[model samples]
Target: MSDLRDAALVSKAWPFEEARRVLKRYQKQPPEKGYVLFQTGYGPSGLPHIGTFGEVARTTMVRRAFELMSDIPTKLICFSDDMDGFRKVPTNVPMQEELAQDLNLPLTKVRDPFGTHAGFAQHNNARLCEFLDSFGFEYEFASSTEYYTSGKFDEMLLKACWEYQKIMDIMLPTLGAERRATYSPFLPISPKTGHVLQVPMLEVNAANGTVVYQEPDGEKVEIPVTGGNVKMQWKPDWAMRWAALDVDYEMSGKDLIDSVTQGGKICRALGKRPPESLTYELFNDELGQKISKSKGNGLSMEEWLTYAAPESLQYFMYLKPKTAKRLYFDVIPKAVDEYHQQLRAYPGQDLKAKLNNPVYHLHGSDMPASDMVVPFSMLLNLASASSAEAKETMWGFINKYAPDATPESHPNLDAAAGFAVRYFNDFVKPNKVFRAPTDQEHAALADLALALSSEEAALAAIAKKNAAMGNEDDLPVADFADDDFLQSVVFAIGKNHGFEPLRDWFKAIYEVLLGASQGPRFGGFIALYGVKETVALIQAGLNNELTK
Candidate 1:
């Protein structure tokens, strides 16, 4: 354990690096709050998406890293800013006209369009918690409405009131003259209309913890900043929450860089330092447009999960977070395969290497073994060639390659088989384009098919000879089972038929036989799908049977 901790101190993984930065904060002494506090804020104005989950997932990764390197205990809080006003109705939900009527109301007060929960924010908050819990994250859920109305934030709310001018001085310079004249850090909730108003504050009485503003009817009213009567603007609210909660570490999207800077200044004005933060680049759609929840331009968490396991999504999140990447359906298969690839490499890695591995951060010391003996890409190809409708169909092929494995023993592989079938049908099958082989390629494929047939015949003759010698079950099939051996045979055939550089031969095999521009190693695919079956597939391609 001590050696692992020593390795963690110098580990180059991003999580450990971020954790070290946080660890520096308490080098002189322990925090006055007794434990480090990690927080992730959410806006429940729209449905929680993959980007929202990434914030909490990445924060947890750093929190896990910090736990590994220090004796200090830590706590994570998933804070939902459900108190923000519902500025516009979402186009995706039902009862849009109803939601439009409730504009300018706090999300917690707006009626749920789905008619399922207490309010719009509550429904979305439930979804946010469901996905977080589904991932088994360790954290406490905090609601902005609950904190304000329950007096948990009263102290900071009062502090903001007293430091109102200071907060204004920090925020005013960032705004134009029109918005600057009316902007107050505090937004008062109107009593009569039940709307959160953005009107100019007529007065701020720090002594009484109240702000005076004229109602829409022109009546002068004094509202207490505490007790949910007023909510701070997002920027000030961000700072006030940090001071109130004593957050040690938090992370936000790249778009929030300026907001983070302003919030840090506001926190300094309120006599507290801001939390250590990482600004991660936002995800983009396939076309490179920034993914927007309202615009519905990218894959959702649910959609990603439908075709791959949740860990793959986390694996995607765990990559170079500072580098922006496209988040779309096409990225799923690669993420799934690479996640298992990392899992396979974890056990053999030395301590320092393990410390740098993602699975170590993702699963910690309780990492599971990678049961995906068949790579996801290979499974997709097998499903494509077989036109598999059920996982059981893929299992027939998987069992031929790994005779001892089963759904119970290799659950990951079992689940991936299911995912591969769905992925092939939904994404691959529709786009598949098989072209007829050219003359040279056709002759090469025929010779390759004949060669595979001879290999099969030789294997059968060897099995018969072994059976006559009372060694049928123990026959030396390893040589024939070897992917490289079969690959070499195919390479020899391709080279004999004038396939210079070899990659063109493989590319032709993929485009002509598999209807894909690229595919898994033909040797591995043949080993999994059986030598005779691949010969039949090749013959079908040559005769134009597949394209027909």
Candidate 2:
């Protein structure tokens, strides 16, 4: 374990360094239990979203890192705050009318408007389990309602009741003047209406562990804090949960930094220390605003998996956990490409380097030994350029490139090809509007077509020229070697025609041929799609047939 710590201290990976810090903290003040606990929270007021997945995935990664570095047993708890009241109905949910009527009631008490579960909270919790199960996350799910009703949290609730004044002292300073006078650490369940009441506590009897509060109908009622008669406010509840579960680590979004700070204070008041906490920046939508479930502005978990692999989404979460990232459709292809690149490079790296790789962490002990047949971005380009609508059409070209490749042997590539077809249709096809080439651009395209028609001759001509210039070794070893042959052929044609700003030449080729301003490398596309088909496509663009 000391060797593990020493090795982790020198590693460049953030997860390793984070694990080192956590282990050190525990050493200083050890947890009450033998095993280390990692917790992630989800509020069951709404359906599971992408942010929910991000938190669990990241926490699991850190937990895995800690498991590798120490002999300590580790447990991950996916805690659901299902006992919370439904302040308002989310726009994305069904049965808005019924939900609106249940405001101020605990989510577990509200009816399952979807008619799929026992209650609203149960529905969301089940959905969350379904979502996490899709990714095969190993976690223990704990419901706040069950914890409260089963008396698992009775000791913490009683402690909060006995120390109510101290908890109030810790929380009041952080609230506004108007809320300070009315605030209470315990919110009692209304016996009349079955809703969680936030009204002021009229009286407190710490000796009896009971508090009296007024309901909406002006009825004063007394209730015990134990046996699920009351629940603490958010900050105090967060602190109590940490102390009750002996949580070693937990993480939340940056917006909750103040809450964490306040909760730490409350934890101290309750005679317990708060858990180690991390604050990660929130995800932003394409519009540069925070992703809101009510607004429905960002990609959902199902939407992302619809167009990309699950590993790609996990990889996205694995990168820069503390940095804010855009979770939109446009970021999907790049994430897929990066995942593929890392997987391809994983087998060649040393042990430490391999462990540091995102794919290695994302896949854990089940990391694949081989790379995908091709890059996902290239597959997208191939699908778009070839006008293919089915995975079979794309697989034809992939099989041509690697004859031995089969779906059974290369599942990632097979999955990527299917996703590429879907992605091209949803995101790429509608935006494709080819432009007619000008006369000068047409001449450039003609030269490019001629070069493609006799690629071997073109490469030989460049090799002869290079050999004459005392740079014989500079000749390309293969047609696609470093794209040397393609670059030489294109540059020779451009220099002969005196074309200005060679970028416009490539732009013309892209816009006319692919109906986009940018795309995969032209040389690779030609090599993969074949010279004859590319020549014909370029000729169609030159003749103004592409715009049709």
Candidate 3:
């Protein structure tokens, strides 16, 4: 294990790189807090999105990496800033009028539109926990409401009262003249109207742990900063949380790079060092716009799981996190196949190599074998070619391609097969356009079809001959299900027909036969879908039967 840790110290995997950053924080002395704390903050203004899950998932990867490299105990906190003021009612939720009436109140004070939870933020917090729980993430859930109301934040709140000017000096320069004029570190919860007042401070009584603010009716009110009477503005609150909790590590999106910096300075102002941090690039929608939780334009956790397994979503979150990537339905198939590809490769990887493999970071030492005898992309192609409406239809081809596999024995593949059919019907089926093959393409496809027909006939003839000679048990029959052989045959036909770049042949086959511009390798498709079935498909394409 020590040797593996030595290798992990220099492993190029992003998780290891991040874990190294956290590990380096304590080279001089271990944390006085006894355990390293990792936190991911969530704003419960809206329902939890894929972005929220990404933060926790990515943080867990780094936490797992740190576990491998250090003997120190680690803790992950998924903190919800539910005490944030409910500035505006989200358009995505129900009971908009009720939410509108609760403006300026802390989120935990707003009514849950869904009528399920105690408050709006509570509803979202429950959802966030449920989402994280489904992924089997090990983390403690914390609420800003509880922290503030329960007096967990009292010590930090009082400290901020004393360092009020210093923290303001750090925050004021970053805001506009107008915002700075009205800004105060402490937003006192209004006792009269139940709103979190964002007014300028009239006075700070640090010795008494209280702040005085002018109410809208021109009355001055002094409230203790402790016991939920006040909440710090976001920037100061972020730093205060770190300082109070002695957080060792946390991460946020690149958009918060400035926030991280501002928070760090404020933490220093409060006489505590900021935790080690990583800034990951944000996810964008299919249109390349940044995904927003309120706009509801991006894929949700539920939607992604509908089309693929949760592990595939984890794989998507795991890859190139520093680089921005599109999060949409179209990207799911690739992530699913690539995740399985890594799973299949994990057993062959040595300790050093395994440290870099994503599956290792995802599942740790309990990584499961890849049961996907068929790739996800190939399954989609099968679904398209078969016009499959059900997993059973796709399984018919799967059963023939891998005789030993079944839905019961290979659950991942079975799940993927079901996902493929749903994906095909929803996405692939709608946009598919079959084009008439060009003359050259038509000739090559015809020849390939003829070749497949001949191969099938030859196999049948050999079977008949053996059966007649009573040599069926003695004679070895030629294998018609050879994937490489079928692939080579298609290649030869394409080359013989003078398709300049032979890839054009395959492309044409896809466009003409499958109503797609790109598809799985034709031979593998044939091996899976069967030679005679592929021949029928080709014949249909040649007759323009499919275009109808």
Candidate 4:
């Protein structure tokens, strides 16, 4: 193994470790190709979802890690299996009845239901490209229809024809008795109807590179496998792709673990070694059901990007990919907040720590030097509570809290504020319920409001005291701005009024102010919302004057 690969194995970073494992396997017996190749596959059955983005993004991250660890050149192929037959109409697409008419036909041959592209596959493929391009992903896209029809897969198709019997033996044992009795690795496209035929093969002529199958109309026909006459069944196709492209690494959802195993066997049977594979856990919905594009059961990429930055989604995928996580709209705020926190810490980190940071990897070599001026969660709150329509309105509040900041200087904050406004209008505003505070909670908030109203006076006094002590430049703003100070102040008031353990007091404050049990740090919230406005908000909550 190279020094870089060795170092990667010990780094303990998951992406690096994954790359190290793949490289180690290659080192044991190198590939036919000189450089590494990473592949991520998409079935153009529906629009790209969060899972699609996750697969491509995670694969890209692994590819990046491999590039960093070794001098070997690398390529990532975003392959679309557009040649696959349309088994059923997608629920999310239009003209479902029209799409159903083309059942069992290659997706690329089906009419574009949305009227936006040449075919069904083309429409989805175009969408996938647009989505990936928006995030500036670097990859080469290959369409299976083009590959097969243009003779790029001729040699592999002929080889599969020659090894048909052997491939059948390898696959049949894994199938049910009925399937085992009739299964063929190749499915011929009927010359008459243009539908892919799944009929039983009568004979295979290895030398002629053809298979004879009885069509639905009861006619036995022989067809070449080489000239897009036939397509490999998915398992065999996956194996053939691995061998044909000499894929070094690839990943799939955990549901494909069995297929990966079967593909490995089929590849070895074809005199080619299977690629190194990782089966990551699939994303689940809030109900704990596995998220599926076909089922339309989880959050969409559009929904995520609509509310948060692309980097936030990338960072969410970067973390613990091997474990299943809920991909829902509710998770967006935390992901956005986490991205900001990482960006903030990135500059202070050492080289090793920087490399380990998710933000550093998300940006590749062009890591940003600073964090956003305000947390996205806070921005969402500010935008929703104030009904801010434009970035200027949010910026007005932000500037009031952090006078040193500017929209031009903090472009990320500006952009985030804009997204938060749109997101709040669409998702948060209609759903939010502002509850009136309890009498005890109301009393507590009233006291906190009184304290906030006096904050300016306290700050002025501190400044005067500092000036007298010959430390005019070192105002005690940090002391007051700290969460500890806010916690201490809330705790002291709550303790005097018989509310125990400061946490309940803080939770009550959050519930009254933000309509949640938790929120952005109170000190930061107060600063961003403006001390006077926060005091008034608290006073409104106490008086039960806020709207529910």
The clash count for each model shown is 0, 0, 0, 0
* 1-548: candidate 1 lDDT, tens digit per residue: 99889999999999999999999999999999899999999998888888989999999999999999999999999999999999988777888888899999999999998889999999999999999999999999999999999999999999998999999999999999999988989999999988889988899999999999988899999999999999999999999999999999999999999999999999999999899999999999999999876666788999999999999999999999999999999999999999999999999989988888888879999999999999999999999999999999999999989999999999999999999999999999999999999999999898878767776643544454455447646434435577876776676567667777889999999999999999999889999999889999999999999898
Query: What is the Å distance of residue 497 in model 2 from its true position?
Result: 4.4
Residue-level lDDT tens digits of model 4 in 12-74 = 777877888777866665555877899999998877788998999999888888878777788
lDDT leaderboard ranking: 1, 3, 2, 4
Query: TM-scores across all candidates?
Result: 0.95, 0.94, 0.95, 0.92
lDDT of 1 at 290: 90
- In candidate 3 the C-alpha lDDT for residue 8 amounts to 89
CA shift of 394, model 4, Å: 1.4
Residue pairs whose backbone atoms clash in candidate 4: none
TM-score of 1: 0.95
Error of 4 at 222 (Å): 0.5
Q: How many collisions between residues are there in candidate 1?
A: 0
Q: Which of the two candidates, 2 or 4, achieves a greater TM-score against the reference?
A: 2
lDDT: worst 10-residue window of model 2: 475-484
How many angstroms is residue 199 displaced in model 3 relative to the true structure, after the best TM-score fit? 0.8
Q: What is the C-alpha lDDT of each candidate?
A: 0.91, 0.82, 0.89, 0.81
